[model samples]
Structure formats: C-alpha cells, structure tokens
Target: MSDWEPKIVSFLCNWCSYGAADLAGVGRMQYPSNIRVIRIPCTGRMDPKFALTALREGADAVWVSG
Candidate 1:
C-alpha cells in the first residue's frame, strides 16, 4: 500500500539490549530499515499488552531484546 516499509517494533532493555543496538549502529552494522526500536528501562517491565497493541496498530513484527 503506497511504498510502505515493513513496520517492525523492537522493545529493548535499556542497559544491555539497547546499548547493543546502539553499538551495532555505531559499528555500521547494516540492517533492514523496517525496524523501529523502542528502548525500555528493562525487558522485565514490558507487558503483554504493549506487544498486542503494536500488532493491533499494524506492526508486521514485534521483537523484544534483553
């Protein structure tokens, strides 16, 4: 539908996972542009509802990193 990029939502832990992703970027790690990452204080804090809401809102994929 209209040159849409795949909507990928990633929930990452603030201390570890988020830092890793940032490192990946800084290292020039090429990845799909479809990803949209959201950093949380911790992966333990994520609720099921948050993932459901992402899909409900039209995300093609949702990933959680810890």
Candidate 2:
C-alpha cells in the first residue's frame, strides 16, 4: 500500500492560532500537508457543530486552539 496520511481539521482563532500558523509560514517552518485550517473570530465563540462536522466529513482528527 501507499503511504497513508491523516487528515486533520483545525479550527483556529483569528487572533491567536491563525496568527501563529501564519508566523510559521513566514519562518519557513513546515507542518504536515494534511492540516486544514478554518479561521474563526474567537475560540470562545466556536460551536461544537464544526468539530462534529469535520469528524463526520472524514477528518481523522480535529484540533481547536486559540
């Protein structure tokens, strides 16, 4: 079989997690290609539905960070 990579869905806060991700890009640091980022205004305002939806949509894992 070919290489199997996990699909990760990440919900990121616009002011925090998103910024960090951008900074990583600026620094030329590498993350796995499997990550999918969704930028939201704030983690406090994030709804449970999003994580559930990602899981249902076949994401191997979900990450939420502010």
Best by lDDT: 1
Q: Candidate 2 on 1-66: residue-level lDDT in tens?
A: 378889999999999999999999999998789989999999997888989999999999999999
What is the Cα-based lDDT of residue 19 in candidate 2? 100
Worst 10 residues of 1 by lDDT: 1-10
Off by over 4 Å in 1: 1-4
Alpha-carbon TM-score of each model against the true structure: 0.87, 0.91
lDDT of 2 at 44: 91
Error of 1 at 41 (Å): 0.4
Which candidate comes out best when scored by TM-score? 2
lDDT of 2 at 9: 92
lDDT tens per residue, model 1, 12-49:
99999999989998999998888899999999999999
Report how far residue 41 has shifted in candidate 2, in Å: 0.6
